[model samples]
Target: MKIARYEHNGFPHVGIVNHGKVNSLPDGTDVLETLNLPLDAQYRLQASAGRHHRVPLEDVRFLPPIEPRAMRDFVAFEAHITGMKKAEPGDGSVPEAWYEAPAFLFMNPWSLTAPGADIPMPPLTKALDYEVEVAAIVGTAARDVTPEQAREHIVGYAIFNDWSARDIQGREMQVGLGPSKGKDFANTLGPWITTPDELEKFRLADGRLDLEMSVTINGVQTGSDRLSNLSWTFEELVSHASRDAWVGAGDVLATGTCASGSLAELWGRAGRQDPPPLTVGDVISITVQGLGTLTNRISPQTSTGVPVPPAWSRRQPKESP
Candidate 1:
C-alpha cells in the first residue's frame, strides 16, 4: 500500500494513494502513530480513509511522511565506493576494512526538508551535492535484531536525498569525527512513502528490490543505477543498526548513494570540471521506478548568524602577568 502525508486546508493528514488521488484519513490522525500500528490496524485506516475525502493528488501539498525519531545512513552499495576509488587513481583501492561490514552515520532528524522546497546552499560549502538513495522507515521498536527479524520492523520505503557539502565534509571527515557540521544543515525526504506490500513485485530472492533509480540536474539526466545491485540489503542495514542499540518506530535508515547517484561520484571518475559542482538555482530530480520522483531546487545561500564562537581559550600562549 502507498501511504502518504499531505497538507490540505492548512492541516497535515495521512492517507492512502489510489488512481492519482489521496483519500485522507479523518482529521487528527498522526502519521507516525498510523504507520506504527499493526498491519490489521493500518489496514483499517486504509479501509476507512475512503469514507472521508479523496482529493486529487495535485491539489494538495506533499510533506515528509513522518518526522523521523532518529536518522542513520549506510554505505551499502559496492559500486558507489568502487566508483569513488576510480575517481582517485592512487587513492588506494576501496579500503580493505570496508568489506568487513557496512558503515553508517547518524543524521540530524531536524534537518529534513519537504518536497518542492527551496534548499539553501550552506554558506560554508561551494561544492554542494546530492546523494540519491532509498530509505526504510522503522515500524516498531526493537533491539539486537537479526536480518530476518529486521524485516518485521521495517514498514515502508521512500526516495531519499542525502544532501552534502563535499568541501566541508572532506575537511571534517579527515579529523575522524565530523560530517555533522556539514550534514546537519539540510536533508530532503519527501514525495511519499511506499509500504513493502506495494513493492513485493520488485523484490528479489535475495531480499533486494529490482528497482531502477536515477537522478537529473536541471532537466538533463546525469546518473542512474539499479537498486538490486547493492552489496548489502536494507535488512542487513536494519540488522546492523540494531546490533546493540535501540531503533524505534518512525526512525529512518537510508542505503547510501547508488553508483552514479551523485555528481561527486562522477567527479571522482572524471575531473571536477567536466560535470562540475552543483551551483545555485540547479534543480535536482531523483526518481525510483515505483517510489516516484522527488524534486528540489537549489537557492542562493543564506546566513542566519555568526557560525560559532571562538574555539581557543581566552588567554594567550605566554601573556605577561
Candidate 2:
C-alpha cells in the first residue's frame, strides 16, 4: 500500500493513496504510532478497515511520510564510493574497512523537508549537490538483530535526497571527522512510503531490492542506476546499525548515493572542471521505481546568523626568530 502524510483542511493527516485519491485515516491518528507496531498489528489496525475521508491528491500538500525518530545514512554502494574517491585529492580506492563492515553516519532528522518544499541553499556552500537514494523505515524496535531478521523490522521504503555541500564537506573531512555543517542543513524524503508487501516481487536473492533509481534536474536527467548494484544490502546495513544499539520504529536507514548519482561523480568521470552547483530556482526530482518521485526547488539562501570573517581579519602573524 502507498501511504502518505499530508495537510488537509488546515490539519495534518495520514492517508492511503489510490488512483490519485487520498483516503485519510480517522482524525487525530498519528501515522508514526501505527508504524511502531508489528507488521500484523499495523495491517489490522491501520491498513484494514478504518473510516477514511477521501481527498483529491492535488488538493493536499505533502509532508515527510513520518517525523523520523532518527536518520542513519549508509554507504552501501561500492560504485559510489569508488566514484567519490576518484574525485577526491588522494588514492581513488575503496578503504579496507569498508569491505568488512557497512559504514554510516547519523543525519539531522530535524533538517528534513517534504515533497514540493523549497530547499534553501545554505550560505556556507557554493558547491551544493544532491544524492539520489532509497531509504527504509524501521517498523518494530530492533536490538542486536541479524541480517536474516532485519527484513521483518522494515515497514516501508521511500525516495531520499541527501543534499550536500561539497566544499564544506571536503574541509571537514581533512580534520578526520564526518560531515557537519555541510550535511546538517537539509535532507528531503517522500512523495509517500510503499509498504514492503507491495515490493515483494522486487526482492533479489542477495537481499537487495531491484529498483531503478534516477534523478533529473530542471528537466534533464542527471543520474540513473539499479538498486541491485549495491555492494552491501539494506539487511546488512540495518543489522549492523542495530548492533549494541536500539533502532526504533520511525527510524530511517538510507542507501548512500548511487553511481552517477551526484554532480561530483559526474565531474570526476568526465575529467573536467567542476560544473556550477545547484543554485536558487533549480528544481531537483528524484524517482525510485514503485516509490514515487520527490520534487523540490532550491530557494534563495537564508541567514544562518553566523558571519563570515573579512579577508583583512586573517592578517598573517609575525614569524618567530
Which candidate achieves the best TM-score against the true structure? 1
Q: What TM-score goes with each of the models?
A: 0.92, 0.91
Please state the error at residue 171 of candidate 2 in Å: 0.9
Give per-residue CA lDDT, model 1, range 1-321, as digits (tens): 678888889988888887899997877777766766777887787778867789988888888888987999898888898877765547647898889898989999999998878898788777889999999999888799999999999989999999998887877877778586777888888688888888999999999999999999999999999999988889898998898899988899999999899887888878664577888999999999999889999998886635676466767574569
**lDDT, candidates in the order shown:** 0.86, 0.85
- Tell me how candidate 1 scores on lDDT: 0.86
lDDT of 1 at 177: 85
Error of 2 at 20 (Å): 1.1
TM-score of 2: 0.91
